[model samples]
Each structure stands twice: as C-alpha cells, then as structure tokens.
Target: MARQHPEEPTLVELTIEEVKAMGKQGIDHPSTRPVITGGVVGAIAGAVLPVVTWPVGLFAGAAIALYTRVKR
Candidate 1:
C-alpha cells in the first residue's frame, strides 16, 4: 500500500479550505478566474442552445470549475 504524505491535505480538507478562502476573499480569491471563465463559457453555450437558459448554464459551469479547482 502507498503511504499518504503527512503534510498533504486530504480532498475534503482542501475543499473546505478553498470554500472558506472563497467566502473570505470573494473575487480576489485564486479560484475566481477559472470559475468566471467557466461561467462565461457556459453562458455562451446556453445562449447557443435553445433548451437551456444562460443563468442556469452560468451557475453549472461555475460550479464545475470550482470543483475542478478544489480537486487540483
């Protein structure tokens, strides 16, 4: 079995810390840009698609981006 690094944080811990940082820092947080980019891309996709609304697409995109960022 592979041993985990003592200094490395677990996924849950990293996610919690990232969430806290986002809440405290708002747009200034490091994860902001990727999230915003994802939102924009989603918005554009939504606009292009007749079934989905821009607002919903924007939210979904941002959430996906945030998840990816946290995992990283």
Candidate 2:
C-alpha cells in the first residue's frame, strides 16, 4: 500500500493574509490606482448625458453607482 498525504487547498480558499506573503500588491491592484476613478469625472458625465428628463441626470449617477457596485 502507498502512503497518503493531505490534500492541498484550492486557490479560492487562500485568504488575504496568505496572498500578502506573495507581495503582489500595487498602488491600487497590482497595476496602479483604482482603474475606476469613480469621482467628478463619472459624476459630470452622468449628469450631462441623461437628457430624457431633468431627473434623468440623477438616475444616471445612481445607475453608475449601481453598475460599479455590481461589477465589483
């Protein structure tokens, strides 16, 4: 009979602390600051785009927030 060893963990099981051991970090995420600025640029774009109605601007900004959150 062959001796058996314990099973190793999967990638998904690794925790943040374990990942830090690799030292694979960046200013934002291994590349630089957050790709999504999520600031005045988005705000201004959303506010200026929605022309269906005055309220559309607010809806646009809200939609941006919703989409980004979901994507994350």
TM, every model: 0.70, 0.28
Query: Residue by residue across 1-72, what tens digits does model 2's lDDT show?
Result: 999998865444443333353246544342122223433345566566665443454445554543444344
lDDT of 1 by residue, 15-44 (tens): 788879888999899998888999999998
lDDT of 2 at 9: 57
Screening candidate 2 with a backbone cut-off below 3 angstroms (N, C-alpha, C), the clashing residue pairs are: none
* Displacement of the residue 58 alpha carbon in candidate 1, Å: 0.2
lDDT against the true structure, per candidate, is 0.89, 0.44
| Prediction RMSDs, each to the true structure | 3.7, 9.3
Residue ranges of candidate 2 with Cα displaced over 4 Å: 1-53
Worst ten in a row by lDDT for model 2 = 30-39
